[model samples]
Target: MMFDNKKVDSGTIGYFDTQQENHFFDRKSARIAVAKLSQSISAFANADGGELLIGVEDDKTWRGFASVEDANPLLDTAFDRLKSGYFDAEFLNSDHFPGFVLHLSIERSPSVVYSTSDEAYIRNNAQNKKVTGERLDSLRRSKGDITYESHAIPASLEDLTNSETMIHFMLESDRISEPSEFLRKQGLLIDGNPTVAALLLYSDHPQGQLPHAGIKIYRYETSGEARRDFLSGVPLTIEGPIYTLIRRAEETAQKIIDSIPRLDQGSGLTKIEYPVETLHEILTNAVLHRDYGTRDYVHIKIFDNRIEVESPGRLPANITPQNILDERFARNPLIQRGINRFPDPPNMDIGEGLNTAFQAMERLRLNLPYINESGDHVRVTIPHEPLASPQEAIVNYVRESGRINNSTARTVTKIEQERTIRRYFAELVDAGELAQRGSGRGTYYEIP
Candidate 1:
């Protein structure tokens, strides 16, 4: 294969023959194993990306070919035919074996895979079968021909506020062009009236109309306490527009950030120890993907050392935590499109956001983002203490202050303006280093 390392010992190369539940090869040479190939390719692309090694014996043995010259022509023909198909496929040939080994790599793309016959198929374990009628129905129900944005709610367009929508559009002008036209194109308006998506994105009081479109934020000193508080105590709910909901969530997150105690350093320049992009990515994902079908609103919980964003409903069919990164299944396509219009559209590339969140945390030495499924809810948890050797100065500042603002962080730490202090503060709070207070310009930092 093109990836074969001659220096790699035989044992490593031989490992390719071991078939996992998701990989397969042709039992007979030259004849295409349609089902086996489809199942392996789809499964690996759906799950974490994996390799499919071909031309290796079923018994995990590599036999030297009778003639390399003869086999070369056959391999070339097979690969050429496979490439012409709809699904994206790559071919590799290895000479390390006495004859040659073929390696096929499949990458997940936005486009769904269908057989050359144009039939959608899914792999169950080792079986390659057409998608069931029930599965197709589920897919239709999830999004349908009309997206969430275009769906007309029972309410009138007059119920939506244009000024609010225009303000938000202006705020995100850098990300979109021709805001009014963009809104119309996204089905945010109907006959000069605002659609539900438009109302959610632009209205100041969207909850008054939909009643179920707001977010609930809760804070507790401990995880158990936070759970108990939500279960029995007064849940702090923030009901308003989607933009307001996002702002409130960020504010609440900042408060949680300020609770972490920072260690005092004589120098004013405080090193921010938390990964901000990861926090923003998680929050943005929750807002964009949350299920709007249910009356239950999205819930956010802050604990002494962690923050959890609980979105309504289970992941769309065919999507799981393991496959979420590779799969580009979106429950709210219209919502996704609208959000993407924002200047900083939260990660849109297939399987990049979650992976980026994980990688960023790893690089910052912060705890990896945690994903949990409970019935219809998907909760993503980002902890603060992903890294050791905490910055004492930052910790002390958070411990003493109730909250911190971007200006304070910039003045205290002297970080660049473009760098997000909110994210850093939120990570610190999640790690039990600081807390946040206030909002907008009044926002300030304090020790947790």
Candidate 2:
């Protein structure tokens, strides 16, 4: 079965020729057994989801099926073995191909997917790893694919019902049901024990149950690496229920950020400004989406030039740094929903927190925040670096120092070329932002 009569360059097949099997892409011969193909389907759906080309061999050769009828066995297993809507299948052929290439694009399932033999698998790098025991449970917990938030804990129902937080929430929501009944209806209380979500939402000290559930904020004096010598004061621990914890952490961090000063044009030294929305969203996400399984609190480190928020988990589910703004997964759905019920909730827009933060940073002309997934953690760095142009930098430098020469402009803007600095000065002068004072070796520019 050929793709179409339409002709395309043989080089177009390079997509398969140069494609190496990785976490997101894999190729297999069409003669592979049904069970093995099922494993690949289960793996891609379990991990971040990926593309699988079933008609290609390990050595980058396109060994497609002889005909559409011959591909039915594999197609049936791919579709029938998994739940509907998990993947899409298409056949491809070019002027250079001898058979039809079966392409399957799988999505990361919200629930774990099992193969035909009921074995669960997850894709890791280039291999389909059969997951069991702790690894399987860890997979379920990541991105709230399974409902870990509703898992029962040792805390009593009274721990949630008697809390002042719950009481206020009930009153504000205008609910007349008893606190225990209300919590039970919300799936927060099971049997006689409070669930994880109930404890985090209503208990006075959720940290009492989950010791590492709160946040720790630190300030470093240096703009470089964080070391013992650069540490400012003692780290501040923000502990409470999830709602209070988020607010306290945000306010405290903002206060420290506000105290930092920067040189501005004509304003002299002014309070350094980073979009408040950016801090709020990132901080809120760091708390709500972090992995509770890890025995560490969310760490917020403030440096001279940036703020770093390290959450105690990798980006959940199919989420990667590149697609964080576009993907939505709640590691703790109940906690997220409960907080949204608060008066003027911390997360005003569900699933749009990071998107809001990115937009806010762009509006301020600041570089977008950097997100990286470390081993057991995800770190987001909010840099204070501006997107000002070279001419603007020169004008600002002259305004702050009363004068800027070629050497000084080069040093301030970090543009190593003296000619580039001179061009910037010329543009600033043409724009009337700076006035040339003299020529020859004594040349200097000052703000007009």
Candidate 3:
């Protein structure tokens, strides 16, 4: 299939409401429960957002609203139960296709909002779950409305020290000496009290205060099957200031990558692999953007096929995984700003880290890393291979470059999973005007 930039999936438009989804289909299933309807609106606003189809049913029936005017009073009643400044009437409209139904598109809010009944709701797996306590705080942090890094911690400037990391940061960023003055100048210290960012950056022992602050690495010998010993061994913990944590994780991950061997499918040869730059950027981003308030450590897992780095937070604000590469919203601005001062920092390019990682993967003919936001954790997976199958990479490579070979084919395609590239080669030979040359591993394919 030819992928393009068109937002509307014409083929799947007819498939909406066949089953339950993030979108709610009202269809006058019952009277609009004002309190209940308000929950949906608040949930959508707090979470990643969703649509409210007023005249659609769960079984794919388009039951028209008794008249759009009839639902106005009901919608208003529901709106009254929602917190002020959260929803807008501009989102409500009628469409002809779904039986002249009303559509309410809720954009994810940047702030934490609640219902007038003093309850906050978040959309989770096509349902609205009420949020309270730490979960609500987590939601607020996810939306970038509040950052835990700037919060005051029970520490003084003495708790912080002039470590080698601090010295490096001072020289690299060309800042003035006197760590106390620098901390005060950067708002990391207020009234002689140290902020979370201050201790994490300049302290010799940040974990002494914030026990949750650190990195954990595990080399899982996963058999890729259902087993009890999935992790396979003991884990390694990386401690110290946040910069040190990032570096430790980077070194461990690089060590794993360098020691491994990758098989080339087309050539049937094994070669010593190299560390992907994507891991460095991702690990740095995880540390910089993680939720520091929670008692969770950054976890890095190295497997046979992929590496998973999980941070203790969701994507901040309106930055979803879908728009993460194109959007910019810093969860911890102080950390981001201060970390840039560190010598040989992993994130030299600030906002371009993820996008750069993806481009670098493509340049090396490997599969782009998969990024996902699962509940309270944001996990990024960097695979040690190419995109799935010989068909996709081989067809595209041969189509664009106009030829392919056993050596160049594996290099470009990264097709290491399969025993042979013959299936895709035969496919192209039968469909496209492809011809084979030579014999065995020395053989190549051409289009003439």
Best by lDDT: 2
Worst 10 residues of 1 by lDDT: 83-92
Q: Report the C-alpha lDDT of model 3 over 1-448, residue by residue, as the tens digit.
A: 1111122243434655554574442233324565666777778888776677555556655555464565565467545643444444422222433223455556677676676576889887778889988888888888787889988887756647466666666777787668778888889886788999988987877888898899888876644357333674578888888777788778887786565566677866465452467888888889999999878999998776778899998888768888999999998999888777787666789999988888788767677888898878999988877554556667677778877886676666655533466766777788865788878877778875
lDDT of 2: 0.83
Candidate 2 lDDT over 58-177, as tens digits, reads 777777888877888887887675566667777787667678888888887766778889888988899999999867777677645665678789876765687888888889989899
Q: Which residue pairs overlap in candidate 3's backbone?
A: none
TM-score of each: 0.50, 0.73, 0.74
> Would you list the rank order by TM-score, best first?
3, 2, 1
Q: What's model 1's lDDT at 40?
A: 47
- Per-candidate Cα lDDT values, in order, are 0.57, 0.83, 0.72
Ranking of candidates on lDDT, top first = 2, 3, 1
Model 1 earns a TM-score of 0.50
Worst 10 residues of 3 by lDDT: 1-10
Candidate 1 residue-wise lDDT at 101: 45
**After superposition, candidate 1 runs with Cα above 4 Å error:** 1-10, 17-19, 23-32, 56-101, 122-155, 161-187, 190-196, 203-238, 252-285, 288-299, 310-381, 386-448
